[model samples]
Target: MAQDADDAVDCGMTVGLYGRLRPYPWTGGEGGADDGGEELRERLVNLALSRAEAYDWYAPAGLRMRGGRSAHPVPDRWFLCDQGGADWTVGEDETGPARELLWMRADLPRRIASARLPLLPMTRTASDALHRAGDFRLAALRAHLPLHVTAGEADGDWEDMRDWFSLAAPAPTVTVRCAVAVSGEETTPPAWRSGGTAAEVGAVWQTLLGEAVTVAPGAPPATSAAGGGVRYRPYLEPARPVAAYRCRVREWTADAAVWLLETAGEALRRTGHRVPVELTAALA
Candidate 1:
């Protein structure tokens, strides 16, 4: 029988530690099946909480539902990270079960309002490829980002940023902005290539981005679709994280892009403009 996607709760909270999305474990893999459902959930929650402990410096250790009302919000597939050797937890309180995971939210204000297009390589570790890239791109676009009317500290204000951008353009729109796809040239790569780590990948990506910008400093011809040839593909990592397991391919679209296109596309669809950018960078 085919395996399920795993019982996990994907809370797409645009503000919490996970920064718009967080998942909790619920079921063990094929080998780690549990007969007790609630017990299993509690176990996952404890695991996530344990992982959150490392992030004591980032934010609150974990997430807390206003009243701890969710019965079982844990997911099955556990996302693990090796940064400071982190892990997640599911634990029981006098009332019931709760789940939490570790993440950094210091850059959230910059995240919500700016445009970010990231090409991420899936790995065996837990450091979020999206968040890491998103934070960088947010910084890049901040100067050009449309400013809010009622602005306070631009770094920490999420609601005001969202509201201001909403007035400018409404539907969710995320342009690829810029992309770098990586590929290996070897006829047969190693079974589990360990030449680098997540931090290393982030560094290399930033370096290359700096190079690309330097290479194309001047604006491209007016006819150019993605200004100065904005769309690019680099040799990213392989499709499989290992020899047999396929790694997920992720694309980081600009948050503002997602919001802008969302509203414009819907309106244009009625008139049959049929925007084409939506289908170009589908994140594999």
Candidate 2:
């Protein structure tokens, strides 16, 4: 989605968005006594440096935090940072949580993503999107470059990446459509309750394919450099990577895990448009 506001053509560059939001009664230091403001700021700075993928767009103006204090004058159109990575924007006041939008474009052109339109944030929600866009895979194939992909820290991605990069495989594409809903006061499945505690601004989803989805009930409210704060849900574990072509796209809710947006979008868009229906997701 690196195109200008009007152009939908994605020449294989990527734009990813991740969010960080905590309800009032905010308890800031989740990272023990060491989780002070300076340490947090350094983390965000280093993360932006890695995620920015360039010095030009970042060097001149550098990063800022929306509604967060500033030393010098804030840049006109700054890319801000937080626990969930960096975001590209006009630095609008956070409508909800502090979300970061990440853009990763390669030094050279690979292939135009077959998506007729530039992809959306929701389309690129899977964990892999955190590394690269699906279009880049196809672009590699079309450009005749060897396509190399990595799995997640967890096994989900390892299994997902087993597919052949080209469209000429026994089953070239795999997609997961998650129907996430707010768990509400209705007890989250016993397995999903956090030490019998529930979370706020919480989002939950079940595979539309009739599979079980469980949040990391006892995993505690975990904070990560990659994902702000997450309640793990082991949903995308692929039984076998080469099993299907038909994908039922996931539905998104406003309250869902903003970081998971990358995982969700990457999961669905991994299809590389080989299937009849090129699966996609939207913020709405």
Once fitted onto the true fold, the runs of candidate 1 whose alpha carbons sit more than 4 angstroms away are 1-128, 133-135, 138-226, 233-253, 273-284
Maximum-lDDT candidate: 2
Q: Which ten contiguous residues of candidate 2 have the minimum total lDDT?
A: 137-146
TM-scores vs. true structure, each candidate: 0.20, 0.22
lDDT of 2 by residue, 64-161 (tens): 34445422213221222222323211123424333333222211112222222212222232223322321111100000011112222323432332
**Candidate 1 lDDT, 45-109, residue by residue in tens:** 34433444353322222333435542221121112222211122222321222111222111112
What's the residue-level lDDT of 44 in candidate 1? 37
Relative to the true structure, how large is the alpha-carbon lDDT of every model?
A: 0.24, 0.25
lDDT of 1 at 60: 27
In candidate 1 the C-alpha lDDT for residue 243 amounts to 13
Give the top-scoring candidate (TM-score): 2
